[model samples]
Target: MTPTKTIVQISSILEKLFEEHFEKKVEEMEALAVSGSDRRYYRISGGGSVAIGTYNANVAENNTFFYITELFRKHKVNVPEVYKINKDRRAYLQQDLGKTSLFDLVIKDGFTDKNRKLYHAAMAQLAKAQWIAGREADFKQCFASKQFDEKAIMSDLLYFKYYFADLQNIQYDRSLLISEMELLSKDLGRVQPQTLMYRDFQSRNIMVYEGKIYFIDYQGFMQGPPQYDIASLLWQARAQLPAAWKEDLLNGYISTLNELHVPRMDEIYFRRGYVQFVLVRLLQVLGAYGFRGLLQHKAHFINSIGPALKNLEIFLADHPQTPAYPELRSLLEKMSAPDMQDKYATTRGSEQSKLTIQVSSFSYKNGIPKSAGQHGGGYVFDCRGILNPGRYATYKHLTGNDEMVRQFLERETRMPDFMNHANALVAINVEDYMARGFEHLDIAFGCTGGQHRSVYAANQMAEYLRSRYNLEVTVSHLNEKKWVLPDAAKTEE
Candidate 1:
């Protein structure tokens, strides 16, 4: 809905609500950023305080949020307190927990110690809400689905198949995949849900204000395992928590569950359920991205697909053989392959108005990544002669993207001399390519191990090209994902 129309509706609702609840009048209301859902949010100001106003044409969803909010607030869950609901239930005003989402903070400071503490605290709160408030959340008011059973799980899988998989032309036995999904659903379904499950409990859905975490977007709350929410939070596509961080947060959640005196969740069963849910959530997210990005042409959503797929790849690599569905597991591994990634690079390929200069870094040990297309080959510059940071014990785990490696390459080597000559040569070629109307160019940097010097070179080349020319640039550290040459498909939007 348009801002003007939404404000008008909010104003009307506020007027009625004031007569019933508060004496304060709203002085101002401005539209907040739109979320993935169809809800319209506004920051309403009044009586020296601010509240959030939510509007949605779908009254059922709004009602669900409202009723759930009431239930949660009654149980002291860290959710926005609802002040008023419109008679039609199309709009409501609730407490404003501030504009900062956990995602915003994470992007600003990464996974720092403070952020880790905050994540743990949020998980504790999540555990409490699920166990304490979840049981009492008026399931009758649950929107769309009341129970996350086999049917719900199948729906999520089918969403991925139709929306995401169909776009890639992946060859797989549909019946076999479905049967596997059914089996997987049964495995997770046995978890015995005891609390309310927040269907979309990611970092973005949790607001961090005044050193406290508050929840939002619980309209899809229903009876489900707490592991699903944990998967959603830790395996969030954009947040990109490292494997270590995810494990730490998982342990924190489990500890909180134990403290809450919740049922003794068998660690073995919970871990298995968590991994399955991680896969399931990845599929659900890919479907959403495919619909919002590929079909609707939203660049951000399109950009997110790469990260989401990476999260999936990480999970698959960590567990190579899916004992349950070998065929499905192989299909997922194929989907994570560079060749498969190329098939799904529609967001950039479809927008062919500008030339895309692909700058990639690889380790010679694993071989160089293929050029983006069959447009012949491109330059492959060897950085093996340069001093290797991988030789150092401290920098072993660090990649070129890390500040330490970047600084090491600049301070401890003849990188400046190499880059100067490399830049001049590439500039000459780029100028010629631009004049000739060539659409693609690839510049690869390969070292003994792609982790260090090559990564540094690729990063520098991408930066230099972006600064010197008005060309579209894509920088991919092919070896960043453990020597696996992921697609050099990250393009500047």
Candidate 2:
């Protein structure tokens, strides 16, 4: 469900829970929907002046909410004071910060340039919260139940598969695509992980009560990459900021971070953070567009496709060196062209042309694979596989450990040969194994069921290949049937 509707549903549940908990009739209940990974909200005027309700509650999210709210309060960051929390019930009571969200302020009448200053001030408060939280934050224990580690990140990468392959019923080489993505994550890990990130720190989540920015909807805080919250604000899909204004806002954020005495804060970090933010937004937009448009029959997200792509295009153009640039560029180019629908159809080819690879008997102990399994006899094709070798290679190089991969792709180095191979082998090989040369390859891992083992192998191989060879790759799970590479017929001969 859309977050808004989910919040409303949760509010109804909370009303019932409060009535049962207090053994009193709910005289009046108003549900104020909030945003984030899961639907959350506040229910007002039911038997008390205030009550908070969260739909998806677990130990990690509950703790995160408590931790972030306490940290923000201690750091003098403006946020509502929690009264009582029924952690087990996913319900809480807190001070009412009035009903004036920054969303209303920005979109409402009389919102002036002065309001931008207020927004920036609110962001500054957020910066202060992050600075202080960064010091005492125990990332390992903070959101332990939520699994916000490498494994969780990998699961997020699978959303594309869920929406594109499973829901949309598109087909592509599952093993190869996944192998490509796993490699990307390792490079992503190189980014310094710090701070308790408020996964959705947008204007809507900030309240303008009592002339201060009061933080809310903060249940999903995590010890994660710092750029997440920063990116959430700057690249907010609903409130699209102009380029110049985004720059000003970013500068304001940096100045606030500096004033808060955050260590090693600079434009470089800001730029890096901004790139991460853009990448996240791109993923979210793609997922939302695909799900809403294709699955839910909601066309509004479809309309957003053009603008979202444009925003990503601008970001990718600015940061040509970002690991996500190649994928972002390919998606943007596909979406923006006048013949996008035609080109997309021609590129995906027919379902019969697709292949699925599975991995058999693979295990990982502390991020290193223990067993290198066979390809398990999946269909093999001679035709060039989907995705140009250059683009795949570029992504692989950007996401690899070797600094030279980054340098070559971002700077003056010539493109490598792996960019030319569409039928490359994609699987976990024993160290120094000589089954096939690692030069030009796109391998996929598949199992009999095409679900668990194949998926796991695809992920492991993708990570290994990206980290080892820095090659552009893609991964797919054949059973889900999501992605489709461009057809050779449409390519330039």
Candidate 3:
């Protein structure tokens, strides 16, 4: 949605929330700068008080955040206080942590002793979140996957290979690369004495509120080796912390972990796992830069590719080649070469992108949408398991595009979890098709009436793919109209 449309919808909800929950009118709502995801955030103030209001369509992620906030506050983890969640679980109000992010501090102060102390404090608190709070929290409330299992690990690796490496022609021997990825995932999964992994831990996610260190953006947390979190924080590319500082902070983290009185790890074994996580984490970030910078044409992310590549180069120099991932090391070695920077620096290969995806929604009662392309490739997702919004008289004439049906399906049904899993399965094929240079792929969603669930799924998936990859995408609701293929050999529009 455009910013204007988004504001219209969000203003309505925020107005109601302020009036009903806080018994005050919203005097002002200022848009805040956000990094990733489609979540909309506003600084809301009224009656000489201020709070942050958030609106997101991803219900599963919202629920995960709400649940984790409650758990973290109960254990003294120093997260923002969640004041209220609106009905439908998509909008909420939380305590505002006063606008000073650790990133802003580093930028303004420029890496001084005081900032270093804040870093140390943040690390110590991370230990508590992992060891004490997250140790017993209900993983069942977690969104998407509960653990960073082999499947999750491999997904990260593939994300790098396809989005970053394949775009740069770095992953040369697809079969061998797959073998190395599987082995690395197995080794990571077997690491013992696991705890919560803050999957996106970084300085930007840390808030400095009233001389205290507070962590945010952790709804992506999962059960995994604790080392991943530290590796993620210390080796973040944009921070560009000095090598000596990184080494010192790493050792400091280990000491803090030991003080927790958990089972002690052999320093050697722990360091090995840390190294693996560091390598994978760097690649994962490069993949993000590729999508946001190269495909999406964002200069801020595009400029960071140089620094991120430098970080990878530094990591490789510190840790020499290992036999466990010869292919991966070779690929990274080539990518890190100072001379090859031109390929990924200013331009993306979007002009050469070959894949086009057709997404459609249909009612099973009418018939499945038939594929007309010569490639003859596609998959159908059955969304009938989702509750039918059509069953209610208010939603009978409304389609998924209508706010009422969208709210009903998202708020009242298990559509979030169902689509989460379905997207995971479809993403595998989509990436593979892109890597293989296929010209066309088809995806369709079906439900009993196709007016609500199927249409919602199809629209959401189309939006996701368009943002994720540099591919031509089109969508049509087959149940609502006749979409005749132009020819047997083609399927455009």
Candidate 4:
């Protein structure tokens, strides 16, 4: 489904859930920013109660999250409470944990004693969670697999290989690299599943609400070494955690685990696994940055590539295991060079002359589409004022590209005035940009569902610009994947 429609439909579902569970009407619902996931989060407030409502099409993952949250609550783990779940399990509402994440805390107060205590508090909870939940939580309830075993390890390694290493065109012995990765995966997989591993245990997932640190986003949690979670947090590239904090926190986590859990974990065994998992976690993230940044061209992910590279470099210099994977080591060292680093992350301004206009249609519910230009300059027209065909059952399933939907907007609504005024504003910008020898221009149309009015306006505007101006024009509907031609014929404005 289009993100616009997804939001529109899910909003009602969530509001109904709030009224049913909270025993009050939903007064306000605001979309929350999400990162690298299709899941939608919203801040829902109603009659003296508030909650965070979530929607994801993945039913299994949703059930797993709700199930795990219940388990964590039983063990008194510092996670938000899950309240109501839809019958099909595609949506749910949970306690609102507020917006202050641990990463936000670290960034605001760097290297302070207070922040040290907060980081330590985060470590303490992770220890309790891993020790208690690992044994008690049922592995049968996990979403994908029970363990972070060889297969899971290989998936992460291959992701790094294909998306990050291979996409960067890094010259490596592919067979040898794969062989080394397989060996590493098998070796690491042999570690006994001792405790609950918070697969994405990082500062950002750790929220500081009501002056206490709480964990969030454990839908990916599974049976694995506790060392993995520690590695995930301490080595998070964006956190820029001090070396002393890394050292102190590792020692502190181990200390807490042994002090709390019976049948105390072997410190020696943990340190060894810590090294390997740290390697695995870093490479996995590089792969994520590669796909989200390099392939998808997201500004946040693209900006993160350099710091990830730096983290890998520091590991190569310091870690003793660097020599074991000679082929992997060779690739990392080559990519670490200043020249190669620029090749992956630097902004490209190579094309200087030809003007290219990118027009997009999106939903206000999903936020605006970001401009790809370096200056972040663009024109965004709110098509909400134009009548929406999505409200009608006839145009409900059909997108703005459908001939009937186009006719509905063209004949039934004020879309012509909307399109005309939009074109006039953009035409001025385009002519001025061309005269100034500028290279790119971005224009977006946003409506309620990004389906009818905005989509139709974008298509009409794209055609209008193409006919009137001698320049390249590309159009897209940001919420949906299907690319359809404008069904109606058009002439130059």
lDDT of 1 by residue, 265-384 (tens): 678977877887888899899999887665544446766777788888888888765435876787788788876555444343334335679998888888877887568546899887
Task: Please identify model 2 stretches exceeding 4 Å from their true place.
Answer: 1-27, 33-42, 46-60, 86-89, 109-111, 140-150, 161-177, 298-306, 320-328, 336-493
Q: C-alpha displacement of 477 in model 3, angstroms? A: 39
> Candidate 4 lDDT, tens digit per residue, 292-381?
655544446655677778777788788856538899888888877777655444332223236788999998989989999876777999
Q: State TM-scores per candidate.
A: 0.68, 0.57, 0.68, 0.73
TM-score of 4: 0.73
Candidate 1 accuracy as lDDT: 0.76
Candidate 3 lDDT, 336-413, residue by residue in tens: 888655434432324555878899999898988888668788989999878787775556666777654555565568
- Model 2 scores a C-alpha lDDT of 0.52
Model 2 per-residue lDDT tens digits across residues 29-137: 5444322244345455554545554444555666666777787787787777776565463666667788788878776843478678777887787677667765776
Off by over 4 Å in 4: 1-5, 344-493
Worst 10 residues of 3 by lDDT: 482-491
Which has the higher TM-score value, candidate number 2 or candidate number 3? Answer: 3
The models' CA-based lDDT, in order, is 0.76, 0.52, 0.79, 0.80
Backbone Cα, N, C clashes tallied per candidate? 1, 25, 0, 1
Quote model 3's TM-score. Answer: 0.68
